[model samples]
Target: MLKLGVNIDHVATLRQARYRGREQGEPDPVRAARICEEAGAHGITCHLREDRRHIVDRDVFALRRTVRTRLNLEMANTPEIVAIALQVKPDIVCIVPERREEVTTEGGLDVVAQEPALTETRRRMNDAGIEVSLFIAPDPPQIEAAARVGAQFVELHTGRFAEAFGDPAQREEELNRLVEGARLAHRLGLRVNAGHGLNYENVRWLHRVPHLVELNIGHSIISRAVFTGLARAVRDMLDAMAGYTGGMPGAA
Candidate 1:
C-alpha cells in the first residue's frame, strides 16, 4: 500500500518560534505525531537538524517513545546526529544533505561523493537493525550510489517536479525523470519513497512513477491544517493518494 508519513517538524518550528528556550511549549511534535497516526498516517517523520532550529533532541526522544506507528528520522550524515540516531533507534533514517544557512533542505544528498561516509553510516544503522534510506534527487548516478552504499531505500526528491508543475512541458519532463529514476532504483533492489513539495494537488500526478512505498510530506499538510484541521488534512492527502495503480504510463 502507498503510505503517508506525516512530518511534524513544522509543528515544532511553530512551538520553537514562541518557546525556544523555555522548557514548556505548545503544539508539541509528539502530540502532532499522535494526531497524524490517529488520522491514518502510516508513519511520523522528523528532522533533528544540527542547528536545533526546530525539532530538538528532547522532541525526537519523546516521539521515539510515543509514536505508535513508524518513526522515520531524517538527519544529516554527521557523527553527532548519527550518534543520536543510534540512541533514538528510529525505525528508519533517511540521510539527507544539510546546510546551516539554507532555510530547508535545498537539494539531495550527494551520495556519490559521500559514498564512503554514507556506507559506513548505513552499515552502523543496519547493525542496529535500522533500515537506511538516502534522500536523493531522481538521478541515475545518485540512485546507483545509494545502492552502492547498500541503502534499503532511496527517497526521490520531487522538488523539481513540483516546481515544474505549472508548465505542462516541464512537468512532463520532470515526471519522466522521476519515472525513470524509480525504475532504475527498483531494478537495483532499492525500495522507493518520495517527498518534498508534494501537496494535495500535485501528489496525485505521481502514479506514473512506479514502486513508491510512501510519501513523507510536511509543509503543505501542516499549512492546510491551519484551515482544515490536522486530521482532515491528512485524510485529504490520503484521499488524493488513493487509487494509485502504480503503472508507469508514458514512461520511456
Candidate 2:
C-alpha cells in the first residue's frame, strides 16, 4: 500500500494569515495532524521552512507530541533547522531545497552539489537514530549521490511531471523519467517516495511508477478539505490510490 504523508503546512499558512506569531485559533495544524491520523493517514508531513512563512517551531513540537502516526519533518539542510530536528527527533526528516522567495518548494535539493554538507547532516541525524531522506530530482546522478551521502530514502520530486500534466507528449516523457529514476534508485537499495503538486487526478497515472512506498501531498488535499472536510479528503485519496499497488495495468 502507498502511504499518504499528509502535509499540514498550508493549514498553518491559513492560520498565520491572521493568528499573528504563535497564536492559536481556527485552522490549527496540530489538530489537523490528529484528525489526519484518526482518518488513517500514514504520516503527517510539515516543513519548518527557513522563512517561517508557514509551519513554525511550535507547530513541529506540537506535532512531535501529538502526531500518533509518523511525523515527517520537511526541512532544509541548514544549521538552525538541523539542530531543531536533532533535538525534536521526528520519525523521519526529509531535507528539501528552500528559497525565502518561493511560494512553495520550487524543486528538489541538489544532493550532488551539496554532498559533503548533506552527508554530514545525514550522519548527525542518523547518529540520533532518526531516519533521513533527501528530497531530490528523479535523476540517476542525484539518486546515487543521495545514496553515497547515506540517505535511507530519496523522495522523487514530481514537480516537472506534475507541471507536464494534461499535455500528452510532455507528460509521457516526464513520467518515463520518473519511472527510470525510480528503477535506478530502487536498484541502489534506497527506499523511494515522491510528492509535489500531486492530486486526486494526476496521482492515478502514477500507478505506473515502481518501488514507490509513499507520497507526501498537501495543497490539493488541503484545498479539497475546504469542501469535503479532512477525514473524507484523506480517505478519498487513499481510495484513489488503492488501485496503484500492482503496478500500471498495461504500461510498458
Candidate 3:
C-alpha cells in the first residue's frame, strides 16, 4: 500500500505566527501530529529550518517522544541540524534544499551539485541507524546522484507537476518525468517517496506512478483542516489513497 507521511511543519507554522516567541496559548504541533497518526497517517514529517521559524527544536524533540508512527525529519545539510538529528535519531532524515527567504521549500535538493555534502550527510545518518532520503527534483541526474550517495530513499519534488494540474499538455510532460524518475530510482534500489504542492484534487493522479512507497504531504492537508478538522482531513486523504492500492476500480 502507498503510505501517507503527513507533514506537521505548517501546523507549527500557524502556532508560531500567533505566539511569535511569546509561547502562550498555541496549539501544539505534537498533539496535532498524534491526531493525524490516530486518524491514519503512516508517519509524521517535520522540517526544522535554519531559522527557528515553523518547527522549532522543542517541537522536534516532543514529536520524537510522542509520535508512535515513523518520524521523518526534514533538514538541510548543516552541522547544527546534523548534530541535532544524531541526538534525536528520528526514523528517517530527509535532506532538502533550504533558503531562509523562501516561504516554503520551493523545490528539491540539487544533489548533483552538492554530491559530496549529500554523501557525507547520508553516511552520518546511516551510521546513526536513520534512513536517509534526498528530497530531489524529478531529474535523472539528481536521481543518479542520490543513488551514488547511497541514499535509502528519494523524495521526488512534485511542485511543478502540481502547478501543471489543469493543463493536459504540461501535466502529461511533468508526470512522465516523475514516472520515469521513479522507475529509474527503483531500478537503482532506492525507495521512492514524493510530495510538494499535492492536494486532494491532484493527489489521486499520483496513483499512476509505480513503485512509490510514500507521500509526505503538509500544507494542503493542514489548510483543509481549517474547515474539516485535522482527524477528518487526514482520514479523507487516507481513504483516497486506500482506493488506489491494488488498482481498485474508480479510485480517481
Q: Say which candidate scores most in TM-score.
A: 1
Question: Clashes in model 3: which pairs?
Answer: none
**Which residue runs does candidate 2 get wrong by more than 4 Å?**
246-252
lDDT of 2: 0.91
Q: After best superposition, candidate 2 residue 65: deviation in angstroms? A: 0.5
Range of the 10 consecutive residues with the lowest summed lDDT in candidate 1: 243-252
Which residue pairs overlap in candidate 2's backbone? none
Compose the digit string of candidate 1's lDDT tens values, residues 141-221.
Answer: 999999999999999999999999999999999999999999999999999999999999999899888999999999999
For each candidate, give its TM-score against the true structure.
0.98, 0.97, 0.96
Ranking by lDDT: 1, 2, 3
lDDT values of the candidates? 0.94, 0.91, 0.91
Give the alpha carbon lDDT tens digit for every residue of 1-252 in model 2: 788999999999999898857567669999999889999999999999988988888889989998888999999999999999998999999999999889999988999899999999999999998999999999889999998998999999999999999899999999999999999888899999999999999998888999899999999999999999999999998887886663555632
The Cα error of candidate 2 at residue 87, in Å, is: 0.9
| Model 1 CA deviation exceeding 4 Å by range | 248-252
lDDT of 3 by residue, 30-142 (tens): 89999999999999999999998999988888899999999999999999999999999999999989999999999889999999988998998999899999999989999
Pick the lDDT winner.
1
Candidate 1 scores a C-alpha RMSD against the true structure in Å of 1.7
| Alpha-carbon runs more than 4 Å astray in model 3 | 245-252
lDDT, candidate 3, at 90: 100
